[model samples]
Target: MVDESMRAALRALPKAELHLHIEGTLEPELALELAERNGVMLPWTSLDELKRQYAFENLQSFLDLYYQLMAVLKTADDFRDLMLAYLKRAAADGVRHAEIFFDPQVHLGNGLDLDTVMDGLLEGLRLGRERYGIGGGLILCIVRDLPVESARHVLELAAPRAADLIGIGLDSAEVGYPPSLFADVFVRARELGLHCVAPAGEEGPAAYVTEALDLLHAERIDHGVHAADDPAVTRRLAEEHIPLTCCPLSNRRLQVVHDLRDLPLRKLIEAGVTVTVNSDDPAYFGGYIGANYEALAEIGFTYDELKALAADSIRASFLPEADKRALLG
Candidate 1:
C-alpha cells in the first residue's frame, strides 16, 4: 500500500494537464444543475441512471453521452462556470499550467455562435489566471468525424480569436476518419501560426500515428497508446522525442487496457519516448490529473519515476520557454 507521504507528494507535484476537454469536465451533478437552469431536458430522471452511463466500453460509447450532456451548456455564463470549476479543481491538484481542449463544432450544432463559446471560455481563462495563477493556452479541436469542409469553416470562424488560440487539434472518432483526412486544414492552421496536435493511435493503429506525424504534422499525440503495438513506431517516437499524452485511467475505463499493470507507460518511458500522464476526460473517465498519477501508481511506479513523468509534462507543454524554465526551477 502507498504511504501518506507519497500521497501528499503526489498532490504537490507541479504539473500540466495537457489533454483535458472543457466539455468533459461537466460533472453529473453540474449537468443536472445546468439542465434545470437552461430548461434543457435530460432523458434520465434520476442521477443514478446518469451515472450508469459512465460505464463506457470504448471511445464512441463515452462520446455519445458527452455530446448529449453538452446540451445543458447553452450560454456564456455556463461556459465560464464550467471552466472556473475545472481550473479550481486542477489548481488544488497542483497544476500550475493547463493546455485545455475545446470542441466548438458541438456547440455549433446546438445553434450557438462561435463567439459565445470562445468569449465565455476566454473570460473564464482570464479569471483563472488571475485567481489561480494557472497559466496555459487553449487548443481548438475540430471533430474528425465531421466533414473536412466543416473543419475549414471552423478555422475561418476561429480567425478573429487567433491570438487567444494557441493551436489547432484533431479529435473525436479515429477509426475510419484518418488523420490524413484533415491534412489540408491542419496545414492551413499552421499557416495561421497555430501549433498542431492530434489524437492518434488510441483507437487507431501505429500507421495512424505516422499519419498524424507526417500528414497532419501533429507536434504531440494525445492518447497515443497504440504506438506500443509497433516497435518501429515506438522507436521513431523515441528518436524524434515526440511527446505522447497518455491518459491511463481513461484508457482503462474505455477498455484500451484491461489492467493498469499492463499499461505501457514504463516501457514507453524506458524507450526514450517523452510520456506524460493526463486526464483526457476526467469526469467521463474517473478523475483529474492527480487521480491519473494515482492510477499510474497503482501499477507500482516509484516516486522518482513519477516525478520524471511530471517533468516530462512541463517540457511537453506549450508554455513560453521562460515560463517553462521558471516552472522547472
Candidate 2:
C-alpha cells in the first residue's frame, strides 16, 4: 500500500500530463449540473445512476457513455468551466503542464460550431494560467471511427485556428480502423504545422504502433502498452527515443488488463523505452496524474523510478525547451 508520505511525495512531484482527454474530465456532478443548466434531459436522473455506469467492460463501453455525457456541454461557459475544473484538479495533482485532447467532430455533430469549443477552451487556458499557474494547450483529436472525409472536413475547419492547437491526435476505436487509413489526414495536419500523435497499441496490436510511426509520422504514442508484445517494436521505440504515455488506471478500468500488475509498464521501462505515466480520462478512470503515480507505486515502482517517470513526462510534452528545463529544475 502507498503510505501518506509517499502520497504526499507523489502529489508534490512536478509533472506534465500528455495524454489527457478534456471531455473525459467531465465528472458526474458537473455532468448533471451542466445538463440541468442547459435544460438537457439525460437517461440517468441521479448521480448514483451515472456513477454506477462508470463500471465499464471495455473501451467501447466507456466511449458510449463518454459521448453521451458530452450532451451537457452546449455553451462556451460550459466548455470553459470544464477546462477550469480539469485544470484545478490537475494542478493539485502536480500537473505543471498539460496537453489536453478534445474531440471536435463529436461536438460538431452535436450542432455546435468550432468557435464555441476553441474559444471557450482557449479562454479557460488563459484563466487557468492566471489562477493555478499551470501551462496548457489543446490537441484536436480526430475520431478515427468516423468517416475519413469527416476527418478531412475537421482539419479544413481547424485550419483558421491552427495557432490555438499544439497538435493533432487520432483517437476513438482502434481495432478496425488503423492509422494507415488516416495517412492523408495526418499529412494535411502536418502541413498545417501540427505535431502528430495517436492512440496505438491500446486495444490494437503492436503493428499499429509501427504504422502510426511510419505512416502518420506520430511523434508520441498514447497508451502504447502492447508495444511490449513485440521485441523489434520495443527496440525501435527505445532506439528512436519515442515516448509512450501509459495510463495504468484507464487500462485496468477498460479491462485492457485485468489487474494493474499485468500492465507492461515495467517491461517497457526496462527495455529502455521512454515510458511516462498519465491519466487518460481521469474522471472516468478514477484518478488524475497523481493517482496514476500512486498506482504505479502500489505495483512496485520505487520513488526514484517514479521520479524518472515524471522527468520523462516533461521530456515527452510539447512544451518549449526553456519551459521544460525550468520545470525539470
Candidate 3:
C-alpha cells in the first residue's frame, strides 16, 4: 500500500528497537549452519521447510519452535555469530540503538551458562559498536510460564551484573502467567535500580496491564495491543505517557491481531498514547525493525507518523536523557 517514496523515507529514518529478542534473530541460514556445526539434528530437512514451520497457532506454539531452535546454539561462537548477524542487518536497516532481550532460562536450560551467553553476546555487541557503529544494551527476561522461584533465581544471577544487564523483563506466554506472580522479583529489581518492563496485553487481559504497572511497577509495557479494549486503561496509559512497544508483523504471525487492519497503532497514537513499533522476534516474526515500519507504512502510515513512531522509540528506550535527546535531534 505504500508508495516508493514513502518506503524510501521509512528506510532512511534512524530508529531505536526496544523489544527485540536476540535469540529470535536466528535466521534460517544461520540456524541450519549452527545445527550442522553443533551436531544437532533438526526435524526439518531444508531451511525452507523450517521457515514454513514458523506459522504459529498462538504464543505457546511459537515458543515451542523457538525453544527447539536453541538446541543448535550451544557454544560461545554460535551466540556471537547470532548477534553479529542481527547487528549487520540492523545497521543496514537504520537501527541506531537496540535494546535487546535474552531469555537466560532458554540458554541455561540447554546447558549453557549465563556467563557463556553474556560473554559471547557482549563481545559481539561490543564488536558491532566498533565495527558497525550500532549502539546496544542487554535486557534479561524471565519466561512467565516458569515458576516464580526460577524467575527469582534468574534475577539473582543477573543482579550482580546489573551494570552489564540494563533491564529486567517478563516474556514467554503472557496469557496464563500474570505480572503479579513476579511481584517480589520485580520489586527486588527496582530496589537494585534496574529498569523494569513486561509484555502485558499480548495475550493477557487489560487488567493484567494494570497489574503490570501497579504490582510489578513496570516502566514500560511490551505488546500492549489489547489495551485499546479498555477506555479507562487506555486513558491512564495515554495520560501517564507509558510507552507500548507494538509489533505489527509479530501480531499477525502469532495471531494476536488477525491482520494488519487489526493493528491499533493509529488509534493508540490518535488517543495520545506513546506507541512505538518494534519487531518482537524478528526471525520468527519475519522481519527486523525496518520491516515493522514498512509493514505499518503499507497499512497507511504517513511520513510524520513514521517520524513520530521513531521519536516514541527514543522516548521509550531506557537510554539516558541526553542520549535520547541526541537521537531525537
Candidate number achieving the greatest lDDT relative to the actual structure: 2
How many Å off is the CA of 308 in candidate 1? Answer: 0.8
Expressed as tens digits, the lDDT of each residue in 147-172 for candidate 2 is 99999999999999899999999888
- The lDDT values for all models are 0.89, 0.94, 0.87
Give one digit per residue, the lDDT tens place, for model 1 in 58-128. Answer: 77778889999998999998999899999999998889999999999889999898989888898899999
lDDT leaderboard ranking: 2, 1, 3
Per-residue lDDT of 273-314 in model 3, one digit per residue for the tens? 999888989988878888888888777787798888888888
* Best-first order by TM-score: 2, 1, 3
* Runs off by more than 4 Å, candidate 2: none
Tell me the alpha-carbon RMSD of every candidate.
1.3, 0.9, 1.4
Give the best candidate by TM-score.
2
Looking at model 1, residue 305 earns an lDDT score of 85
lDDT of 3 at 322: 99
- Lowest summed-lDDT stretch of 10 residues in model 2? 54-63
Per-model TM-score versus the true fold: 0.97, 0.98, 0.96
The segments of candidate 1 whose C-alpha lies over 4 angstroms from its true place after superposition are none
